[model samples]
Target: MSHSYHVYILASKRNGTLYIGVTNNLAARIFAHRNLRGSAFTKKYRVTRLVHIEPFNDVRDAIAREKALKKWNRG
Candidate 1:
């Protein structure tokens, strides 16, 4: 199966630490963060709950969306 790219945000909790990332496999990526894998930032901040996600057919669009979310004020 072909996988689409996704821009996603993970939070430690509601209104807590936020992390923005782009991934081709959303489930596996989230799982890794949750399990405290190789992600230093996410693991250090304990940001594991999936809060937001935007799917993109193109890698450029996914990266752009991730960048946009990174600039958003945490709410």
Candidate 2:
């Protein structure tokens, strides 16, 4: 069997606070975020909307991309 990974961004509102994360199941993760079970930061900031997603065949690649995105300037 093969596995796929996802890098996703969630936002509180359009152009609002952003949350970046990697997951194997995007739907479930998004559901959790919407239900206030995703993470401390995401729940606190209300970043529940699925604003963006990137698919990757390797988990390492997905993680790397997420790390790079997190390091980006928020300006």
Candidate 3:
């Protein structure tokens, strides 16, 4: 069996605060975020809306994509 990782983007609202993250368990991560247990930033900003998700075969690739997305998000 093979495993896939995900690079996901969450938004507070339409065009609102954005968050970039990587996870092997997308559903669980999103659940945690929505329940205020994933990240402090998400909990504070209410960034629980999933705007985008990308799948990768490797965790490293998922992390790299998350980092790149964050860089783009910053600027």
Candidate 1 residues lying further than 4 Å off, grouped into runs, are 1-3
Cα-lDDT of candidate 3: 0.90
**How high is the lDDT of residue 46 in model 3?**
96
Q: Give the top-scoring candidate (lDDT).
A: 2
Compare candidates 1 and 2 on lDDT and give the better one: 2
Say which prediction, candidate 1 or candidate 3, comes out ahead on TM-score.
3
lDDT per residue for candidate 2 within 28-59, as digits (tens), equals 99999999999999989999989899999999
lDDT of 3 by residue, 1-75 (tens): 555898999999998999889988999999999999999999999999999989899998888888888778344
Mind sharing the TM-score for model 3?
0.90
Off by over 4 Å in 2: 1-3
Best by TM-score: 2
Candidate 1 local Cα displacement, residue 34, angstroms:
0.6
Pairs with backbone N, CA or C atoms under 3 Å apart (clashes), candidate 1: none
How should the candidates be ordered by lDDT, best one leading? Answer: 2, 3, 1
